[model samples]
Target: MRSWGKSVDTMSSSSRSSQKENVSASRFGPKLCGYCNEFLSNLDLNFDQLNICGWVHSMDYHDIHKSARSGCQLCIVLRHDNTDPEDEHWHKAALGAYYKGRASIMMFLKSTSTTCYSAMYGQLSETISYPGTSRRQRVLDELDSIGAYHDLNYTPPKSTESQTAWELCDAWIKNCIKNHSRCKILHSASWYPTRLLYIGHFPTGYLDRDLSSFNVQLHLTQDKPPKGGYMTLSHSWGFIAFEMLKLTSETYEYRIKNGFSYIELPKTFQDAVRLSRFLRSDYIWIDSLCIIQGSEDDWIHESKAMVDVYRHSKCNIAATAAQGPTEGCFYPRDPTIVSPLEISLRLGGEEENPIPKKYLIVSDHSWHRSIEEAPLNKRAWVFQERILAPRQIHCAKDQLFWECNQTTACETFPFIFESHIEYSKGAAPLALNITSLDLTLSEMRKLRFCETRHDPFPGNFISYPQESSYSTYSNISRFDRTLAHLEGATIDEKIERLRRNIFLDWNNIISRYSSLELTYKTDRLVAIFGVASRVQEALKDMDIYVAGLWRSQLPWMLLWQIRISDTPPSYDCGPSWSWASFNRDVYFYAIPQPHDRVLINVDEAHDGHTVAKQGAASSHRISYLKLRCLLYKIEPDIAANSGKQSRTRFTTPTNPRLGFRPKSLHTDCTETDDYWHQAYIILVIGQHEENRLWGLLVRLCEEEPDCYRRTGMCWIDTEAEPNITEHVRGATDKDKA
Candidate 1:
């Protein structure tokens, strides 16, 4: 075999020379063609005609409007003068077939190494369709049959103006408390925290302030929990006003125990207290007030109960408009934009006998849109608050939005809002729950395929339009949607599937959570621990619970990829081997179903000092893992690099993972340090797919000899297959798996 580190220039030159000599002259159609009295000549070709023709130099073809550059493969072979890559213009009469379409655009972008091209393609592909009809037209036509088209076109009246959000919040809360029992403060469910603040009462027109002293109480264990439900405030801590009363261990024991008052509190907390009293809720849970600041024990204890605190509350008051607590909950918006448009339709033809119709077009904003554009909605901590809370009243800039487990409503079109039940259940069809009869495999495949195509990305956690769309207007209710998703022959089988899917969803949630920014890096595991706890409860029957991965399907969970173009932190947050190690975006692709993948035996896990242990979970902390598996030394590919030394790739010494090729291990930035070269790869698991063994790649830590981190995720089929023969290397004396 040739050496691995060959120069790329020598290889390309030799290959090109051989290709030119073998070209057949007869294929050029007499070598010349006349177009507009200009002679165009055909040249020797290599690769394929489609590949050559599809080569585009610039992606922004419209901005660079000109003939195809000579750098394009097709330009060297076939002479074309006028064809616009962006337009229907063709080069030579014979090669005039190229046209602008999504497929061609994808082809041109696919050859690029830049991830930005892929991101751009993803955006452009969303609008691509067959010529003649715009994507927007398709959407409008789809809505036409449902009578939603009128609502779609309805505009606000010229004279109408927006209303104050405070009035709207009052109206929504009073109506829900009176009519919706589900939203009413529960009398029996009484849960009290260690300390509570009595936000001074508010009167009809405005809130009365008693700045001299603040009412604070330290609830006694003997005291009965509040008879009525409490309200929770979910807002960003924009700035802490020290001038306000501060709580500490000393104050909790001495000053606050008797009766303390303070003049200062953030605007958000003040607004929340006002809303709480207006809604008739007695108690409120404000973290800054309830928990002693800088007390680790209290923080940890309270943080663990985050899910319960939000879930049991009567309602969470989300300051969606506020960037910080100081800004308050209310946001200013244009009066004209917030008001609905009026439309008049003519029923009869001709002005003499025309029948005029008037319709009110309510500019109803989807709940998804309201949450997506909100500033507070972007905070990571608030996400869990929104998800776990049984109900939330979003104080958005334009209007107040009501959301609970049952439904979502906004001020402009409260009754017309979508049901949250179906949305929360995900994309399963409603039919599976209605009928006890088994669905044929063919039927199940049809339903599952629909879920696969939605392409739920990390961003979906933030935008949620796909899930909302599936649950609201789709045929299934949220309750039934769960049944549809977990369809199986028996209840036990269905439960198994549900457990597996729940874990999958956890992976999805973590993928998004990892990408989000946090004020404290240490809070990484703590921020998502509640979600992990919830998933653990769902998979309780399963024996294995490793750090972030489950023992039952650890192999599949290990197949996570840190998204390309995302910059990982220089300092590790957790173990490098775990996705939590990098404070960047990570994603997991579902493993192909029913594959023959065997977990490496623990006995086989160790070589020298390396130790392998089954994964274990700790309370409110990161999981630790160690596995001793196959190790491979990386080397430069000389044969592949003959033509360009700069473009040379690193490959394994011996053929590893036969059918599965290694993905590019490099980060998006070209200036990244050569850490991978010094890094060693460990095979975590082996999969038998299509008669070949595919192994997952893990990067070994030089500092911590036994530990390793996940590198580029999958070793898949690649366009340029480098020589990656495995190199046999002996393990260190103490290198235990």
Candidate 2:
């Protein structure tokens, strides 16, 4: 990204001129004496003016004509006043001329000044020709003459001796330790060859060789032949030493009192020491160096700590990579295959000029198995003696195979809902509800049903819950009841009953529906009805019900089914009584009967007077039915409030019955005249509240004609006499008629 600004081209010409002039007069430019400057000013200078005169003549001319730029010689006599005080412009002009290819002019200017080479180079590069090689060489030589080369290459190599393989490996190990301080080290047989060759099986030829002889171990069995040519004698020696170091470091620390010892040999030991000096270690405990290898007692005693040495080391550098194919090394070969006679003869010391070979045996069976199977075989064989016991290898492999099979089976299993449902039914009811009962049941039945008709196991399976709730009622009681009830009932009747029942229950228990107050122990059961109740209450409150039940820790309600009307009706104007429009005027049938009940009468205009007429005129009866329907709708709220035991006393509203007195009434009527109407309203409200108190009670008794509970009842009304009277007085008698 470029800097946030316009380019320098946006600057005015005056600003550019000022910048040029400032640059010219700065000390960074070529230094010039007043005489030289005067000479330049007097000359009818062209770009090549400096080249026209000889150096000596130019100098002489500059001294005489230095102040001749002014017209009068007498003006030059007034030394200070005659000289141009604002010489920046002239300096800039000189720079401009140099930049315009006046190399000789810049050279002339530099020759007349006492500036250093660097300053001359700077001015030339900025205003004239750039500094050439000769100038740079002079600067470097000057610095060298003063002796500053010591800081250039501070550290130097000690010697030119070539590093042996063992030395290189040891150094690499130390470097690894310094870099990674927290990695565990492990090793195998190749890491302890010296001890193994001495105590374990080895060819007589190898054993009888002179102690100083470096011979690589070789394998005769045929498989893939080792990759490289014969190993060198010197490299074999390095391998032995490397192995010895690993064994000694890993095994000797715990046995000896001083915990330090050295391997001693005549010429061989001396060469090993010299070669080992090239190696480095941050903290190594090589077994040969750490234990008195020559002493059998010490070796036997110290060998016990070998496990800790390898296990605790930052890293182990095994000589596993040291040997190459064709080298006579102890490379493990497959036992099932036999080597050719010629190859065996070559590997053995049969030939007149036998070549030495070193082969890295990956394992005893390198080519018999696939790449995927190789690791298991190697892990089993390599660590058999030190880490794994002979008997455990088979068991370990079996376990590994079993686990892999199990994983594949799980992934490939097919989903069957019937089988799942069957399985769920077989399980304990509590457990079923607490888990994926629906899914389990569905899958059980699906598997069974599918299996009877076709294959039980499909190619693959993905299963989810069949329904939100499947184990809420033990033995599927609720589902059975619902099915039975819907057998002969109309959809509208079922819906209306369900609505009334839910509203009454919820209204009765509304006060007790707080999340903080209710405690839900299990997810299954609570996810069903608990969720439903909260949703119903939230809807009634005239608040947008954003489902946050999951966000809350306590279970509130479970969603069953949400019904969205085709034409979205206003909340208060909905056909059914909603919680918000509970007391609003509306008419509905109580039980679909001709003359079932008259709950409320709001048409009577007499003050404190009301009439409850059963099977009256259709208009009057409908009007009365509307009031009763509205009252019945409000019952759910009352019932909902009553459900909560903690606040059961306050379940019903304080004013259960509402009475209105119109001002157009001729005379006030006694409470006795409207006793039935008032009593009925009170009775209905109280019964609704009671039903809400216990859903089961409402379910059982609500069907009775006089099922109202009278204990919890109260009344409230506003005085509308003034408004009624004014409306009546304003209207002409004919209008009333």
Best by TM-score, which number? 1
Q: 1-737, model 1: which lDDT tens digit per residue?
A: 11112111223434433333332222222211111011111111111232234332222222112211212212222221122333323211122111223122111222122222110111121232211222445333333322321233222222211223444445554445555443343223556665555543455545434445555454442355565667888887654444444566766676455644333566677667666765566678887767877666777677777767876777789888787777777555433334322222221223532543332222122344456557777667776776666667887766677765333445544322432321222332212211111112112322343323222111101111113322223433333455566544444444434444455445545665666667766556556665555555434444344445555555556666664544654332454445655667776653434443343323211111011111112223333444444556665565656675544355565543322235434332233456456544554333233232334545566767666555544443223332222211122324333
TM-score of 1: 0.59
lDDT winner among the candidates? 1
Give the poorly placed runs of model 2, Cα more than 4 Å off: 1-171, 181-275, 281-300, 312-737
Cα RMSD for candidate 2? 40.2
Q: Give lDDT tens digits, candidate 2, residues 540-603.
A: 3222221112111000111111122233222121111121111111111111111112222222
Flag regions of model 1 displaced more than 4 Å: 1-189, 199-224, 239-245, 258-263, 331-335, 344-369, 419-480, 485-489, 541-546, 564-572, 590-592, 596-623, 628-631, 644-651, 654-696, 718-737
- Which run of 10 residues does model 2 get worst, by summed lDDT? 402-411
Q: How many Å off is the CA of 388 in candidate 2? A: 13
- Measured against the true structure, the TM-scores of the candidates, in listed sequence, are 0.59, 0.15
